[model samples]
Target: MRAADRPADLRRDLVVSGEIHYFRLDPAEWADRLDTAVRTGVTAVATYVPWLVHELPDGTFDFGQRHPHLDLVRFLDLCAERGLSVIARPGPFVMAELKNEGLGYSVLRRNPEIRAAGWDGERRPETIVDYLHPAFLAAVDTWFDAVIPLLAAHAVDRGGPIVGIQLDNEIGMLPWVTNRPDLSDRTVAEFVEGLVATTSREAVQARYGVGATSFDVTDPATWGPALRSPVDEQVLALHRDLGRFTRDRYARYVQHLRAGVRARGVGEDVALLVNIHGCWGERATMFPLGISQLHRTWADGDTIPGTDIYIGDLDLDTLPGLWTSTAFLAATCRADQPYGVLEFEVGSGDYGEALDVTTGPEAAGLKLQLAIAQGGSLVNYYLLAGGRNPELFEPVGDGNDRIAFTGERHGFAAPIRPEGDLATWFAETVHLTEAVTDAAELLRAARPERPPVTIGFVVDHYMTEYRYPGSTREAEFVAELERFRGSGPREIMTRALVVGGYAPDATLLDGPDALADLPTDRVLALAPTPSLDDDLQRALADWVRRGGRLLLSGPVPQHDMEGRPATALIDALGLDVGPTHAATPGRTPFVAPSITPDGPAWQGAEVAVGFAQPLTTRRADAGTAPLAHLARTGEPCVLDIGLGAGRVVVAAADLPCLPQIWDALLARLGAHPRIRITSDSRGVVVVPCRTPDDVEVVHVINVSPWDTAVALERDGRPVTDEPIALARRSGTWLVRRSGETRARVAYRPPRG
Candidate 1:
């Protein structure tokens, strides 16, 4: 069905959902808990229908006959009666601290072949199944066959409350580590089949030479490469291809599940939801195989792919990852679809290993604000209330004590307490819900403006798993690529951009289309690895041909994605790449340093690290113009060349490491933000979103510990003459429409 013909629920904005596990709570208290959901201004209630809970020990289905609380249809009807929408999660694998990760105990006992095998050919620590194993898929199909029809009956299109259906929960968390690849036979067969279908054996032999005949693609340890002083070309190719194949399998798994959901006859407005885990660096780096490609894997027009964001003590330092991941997810999602935070933290849960998240309305409000500012539309609070686990095991020692799965009173400091009383966060929840409702019409139609500077990125470069691991020349090159494109240019520079009061846009350099649609007036910063995708090289050449200003860092592309020499963009620019010179700390400097704190990239900056000077260069032709020179070499380190109507700025030094250099470069280009924001303090992120009707709202968030006087201006003219003093670690939204511009002063902060 066409999107326009879908139900009004699809177009209606402001979805404030709270998760309430109906099966975990008593049937008598379900009405009261649901009442709390509506009273706290929740438009919807989300619940996970565990397969283990519903399926009896005899492999027969039991929705509510045995226990009244197990009646999912009845629970959903109750939510509808209370005017609340429902997000039903019928997970064949729901990891809610349950035995077997919510899969029925008999499931694994009956079908041990479904269990995912680790890299060492051992079963995974958790009862996680290999996603594509025949046995597993069969089991899941049986489960879905039983559950989908029931969910379809309760769907909103049929006058039921179910608006969304979640396929699986954290799909790849069980074996996400590097050495934890699912090495099961079925998984290996699929991987081999995919490789044979997509890759050419002749090319593989040519690249690997004579000894490639003995290498087995089906073997896990012998799958990719054997570490050596100098890795063979065949090994490298095999490794890279393996990474691609793995990513493809993950994508196919989601695709298959989504098809399963769609085949169940779900309505157009009743969307399928897939949640991607880990919004920050630690998880992204550790599980690069899954987290890196999950966004790209679950890319579908009808499905909503959302991230799971948990703000605990470990993740406080990398809050910007939330913004980066959100931006990437939004970019990766279907155009016009609202990106959501599927599992947003409501509060800390005291079950299993305790996670202590600060419990206060201010922190909760701040997280919600940040998500919205970073372009999150649909947000589901992880839990709205706590509940007791059902009796699954018999008593062993004490008469009153039974072997409960996650302990009886699984308390999560949420809006509703275990006894059904309102928590302190109730008011905060209501406030955010009301605020989103008031601005829903405008926000639903609004899109973030392109930043003055856009960071062009290649996904493969950041996918560390694709890199051939060894001490070989190829390995060293990959290491250099990691360093060149890793920290300074990507993370630190983005932080600099944000702190400078500009909402930087991260543009994925996948193909020519992303480049063609790039803001023509803005500066495109392209800091990529030495190995570039051939298609991207062609796109870059095309982009240069059509008058697009670019900032090129690191070495010129010497190889393609397949490790073949390709210099399409380099040849077009007509540049002579020269020798490298490592800059000494506190010694190496710009030839003539002239820096002023003018632009947002340079506002109140005090950088301690030495700037990264990558290499020195000299122009190959007279078409280039020298901009700046390296002090150590006096060679042309920074130069600009005119291509067609556009100009390209090539820098030898890493622009991110040197904020002053970045500032000077921007100054030279005469590039400035369209809207200017000035603050009395630092660490405030100012994001401006404009609706289709040109209704603009600026969201100012203080990420620091101190308060600040903030002022906003468009084209150097103040929207309001007076500067407002914003509270520390708070967000103040300023909206202006039809000549009426003002701050939301009546909006209360969290009281002491």
Candidate 2:
């Protein structure tokens, strides 16, 4: 590919890169590290140019004049000479465990007014600055003026190696993680302006019950001791409005940086990337929160959004979360927008040096396979090689003397140790990268096969970020939302479907045309809370009337998000919503399918209800049939109602992770898995992808801890007569050529 066409061209191919911090590594070891990255079959290298490291105490910049390790230009040239492309990340807030989050200390220390303040009107404990504050943006502009020119000169368009530029590292991460929204005066002003622009000034005043002007619209004090006794609709509305404003502010900050860099010689041909942060410690229950927070930044298709995946090892428990996270990322993107992993975790999970957490050697390879299987085209292994942390230009005398807070030697658990020795996982990394390179063409051409079901992704459901510090009402509200959004639907429902051999896609309901392109042949499953938006309720009713099959779990929505009456879906199904009952200590609630001798065989099977809260509803018309009933009372917990040309199955009870139950439920909606695993083990997952030319490949992953033989079939026809022996935590891709099956080992655990 031509240098000018590198960014766009790289997207077409499976671009596997590794992050190597040149500033952290010794100048003498640059060549060796570059060669080591090349040996791993990586096509490019990514590094963060920390503004804290290069900026001098006098506000001037130093590019290797003061320290040899700070020579970014020399490192870029070396990477280019070694035939490796580059991805430059110059961050005004690169949170690589650095003080002030990679910003110069003088910047924050001298201008404390730019610091972000929380709902308490106090500065946040973290050094998170107001992203769009005038002072902070001015400093960012100065930093960009100094760094973008250097990066632009080395960019692919200038016959250099830089292929992409990451705008800011993990935008809106600190605020979310710290639960501290920027409630500074400037931010509040901007929020009021946004509210007025979107709605009217009168609307803002009426909503907040404030003075006649937008200036009187003050930030709601949701936190601290001043919180209201019973949190009312006004507080919830303000919180939601603030969340929306924050997302818009983050997007504007990115756009401002993008414009600044473009003006400073960075061409439009260079791919601009954003690192989305949400998942942490391998748990992906709240991963969609990051997408919701930063959706405005990348939803326009102008910029590419990459998820920072820190999911350690792939197991049956973690597989569903990873798959859902990856699938959701893909679903949120435009058809032409390519998404990838920005910080693909590698090595041990000992960031704090106290957890004693160790990632298995085979973890990286398995994650790579799963990511690719779920439509990831690019992979950047974070800390592919380790290095020593350089001394800060001006030390603050805060304990350890290093630029980063991680200590003297950084990335000690990486595949390449800080001392330049290969770690235990190096060989596995090499194998996985080589395998991807071998099948680059096929993988690039293939796309995930369309599944028979599409799960509804409700962005507002995850707007549970703001909370009163110790308010019981706030705690209960958050728990309730988490149950419906995180635990019940995301964790249980998603896992049950995937493990049951069903590949389901996701559709973001926040979009204006959410159901416009929804396939009528597929079942649309949603986990609704007690309340849903009025517009969405109507849209879903119309969709069902237009012949779209619907499956709903949890309670029937009787009100909108603000707790106002809105029951279009319930009314359409001819059902009366009833009270929800929780399982008590002694009298445990259970649900069982109603026995029908002539019904499907699965209807006779009993559902194992383990701690599931069941909601009771009554049929108001003859069109509704009781599929399941609460064992405690005989009230219908699961109902199948027929609409004009479609059907709606209301599963009022939160189902557990039972494959048989999910299979039976989906079967009722005329949905079946294309790929089936007829194995006793439920740990194996099958994902099928097909190229444009009709070439088919199936990815069989065994996420269990023990070896198992899996029998796979496609459309009820067996692919192979003999069972395929898969080692523990291993996966393989089988390609069908004519009448023969060829196996490409993606990752296999080393045998004893």
Candidate 3:
């Protein structure tokens, strides 16, 4: 659905909700816990309707007839009485640490043939089922028949508390997390059928090389030379095809479920959401993998896409990854679809009881503000209230005694403990929620300020999920993938730009017309690799010819995505580039900065360490000027080439994250930061959002672990004369009106 065509109630807006498992909590205390959530300033509450908890031993279901905790209707009534909306998550496969991933044990036992198998033709260790298998879909249809009707009756259109219905819980999460894509017989047959239908049978055979017909095309082996260094072109091609096929299958599965739910009385009035899962712990490097895997699921703009962010803190090391993740998500989304966070990290990080560290209250505050600053309109804190995991109706001797794997009392680190008492972080949660609630109107109408630079997002770079388990060459494969298809270069470049005081926008480069749509006034930066899409390479060349400033880092494209030699970009711009190589063991690799007479005095040598490998660029045309050269070798590793009406800066070296280097490079392209911070701390991030009426909200965040005072500027004008003092790991918004001379601070954390 288009943005203009959306129903009034389904319009994108600020929704601050918290996840509260009603089935896990005692039914008697449901009112109190929900009252606490309302007191915390959340407008709504989200809960996963675990099928495992509501299903009976027989083929029937139980809606509190046998157990009080399973009374979903009662919980909805309580929410409506309190004037609180609900986001019901009835998952056919809810991976909330539940055995069989929240599916009915009886269903799985009865349909054992539906289980997903690995490359070895054996059932995978996890209880994940083949998503498209007939038996599995049939089971899901049965489960949805029991759940969707009840949810529809409680939907907002019916004067009930239900505002949104999540189609499924993190589709393809288990397979990706386990590195075991379903290779079951039925799945493989369907994949082959899809391959033949999408591309011709002849093309499939030609790509696989060994296949004479579509049926002969088998999946690549999980071991041996397929995953080793110098991988065969046929094997690599098949892997890419398999990745595409898996993503297509996931999209089709979601489409099927969406149709099912809509057919069962759910309609456009209630928002449909899809939770995307990829990031884990403190690193968001692989987050884009989820985006690529599920891009097709929501590309039609029917359902809203929300990422499941589990990143703990916003430090220098992790901040860039989160920025990349948010930017990439925005880049891939349609203009009408606004993204959000389905599982926003809150409380503590000790889910396993092994990690004795607690996530600071400031962490959630910073993350929430960051999400808002990046155009996020919806957020649901994963666990706001802890509760007990109810026992299963029938246990099958599986070590897990309760419905979930996280022991009896789950979510011990939540703001409200299992016993109905408030945790230490409860007050801070209230403060942050109130702050957002107060600024809801301003945030809903505001859009982030457009930056002068655009970062190219290549979805294929994140399609590195086909790792062979237990292979001796696994480390080598991972290293190679990191160099070619990982987020290493993207991370370094984003870190440099943000630290250099420039917030850049991202655009997906995989689309056919993406490069044509990019603004020529802004500089376009991309982390190019040898195996870039051939079409994209040609488009980049054309983009440069059309007066678009280009910044190409990492390796210059030498081969197409199919592993065939193709150099449209290199050939378009007169350049001679070679393969990238790591620095010699004990020797430091450095690039001497360019010192042109007429240009800005770009001082300091940029060094490459650890995983920052330097690519070799031998020569360029006479029109090219050397921007930076390899330090002792004196070979030009960074060159400024003037092509047609545009200019391109090719930095073959993946330099370390240095603000000075990025500032100097951007200065060469006439790109200056719109927002700047003058502070003692280097970890400060300044983000600005504005409404059409010229009301601006500047989000000043200090990601450092130490307190600091900061002064900000926008478009080269001082925001305020008085410096804003920010405590460690805190952020605040500076609201500026068009007529107002001074800016007012909002959501500023109290100083210790």
Tens-place lDDT per residue, model 1, 1-752, is: 01112222533464668899887789999988887777666678888888887877678778887778788888987887787888888887787676667887677788888776653354556775778777777888889888988998889889888888887887766655333555566665566556566766555344444353444443444433321111455545645665566667678887877888879878777878877765333323222223456755556666777677765422224544555666666666666666687787676433334553354466566777777776777888877887877775323253334223556765456667677777766787777766765566565655677678766656666555433334265566566555655223345555655666557666766655667776567777666666777678778767766767777665566677657887777777765566555457655444433232332323333222234343333345566656555544546656667777677777655444344556656555555655666786656777787777887767777766677888877776785658777887777776777667553443435544
lDDT of 2 by residue, 1-752 (tens): 11212332455777888999998888999999888888888888999999998989899998887788889999999988877889888998888877778998778877789887776566766887888878888888889889999999988888889888998998888877887777776676666667788888778767765322222344433222222221343556666677777777888888898889889998877888888888866676678788888878887796778888887778877776677777778878888788889899977877666767778887887888888888888889898999988888787898876798888989888888898999877987888788787787788777889988778888877777776463555556566677776325447777777777777778888734578777798888787776677788878888888999988877677766655688777766766755666666776567777754446424344554544333344555576667777776777778777788888888787667766677877887898898777777778888888888877777888788888888877766777667789888877887765545543444344543
Let me know the TM-score candidate 1 reaches against the reference structure.
0.85
Residue 13 error for model 3, in Å? 1.9
Candidate 3 lowest-lDDT run of ten? 1-10
What overall lDDT goes with each candidate model?
Answer: 0.64, 0.77, 0.78
Q: Which model scores highest in lDDT?
A: 3
TM-score of each model, paired residue for residue: 0.85, 0.93, 0.93
Q: lDDT (0-100) at residue 512 of candidate 2?
A: 40
Tens-digit lDDT track of model 3 for 513-555? 7788787998988887656767888888888889999887777
Clash totals, every prediction: 1, 0, 0
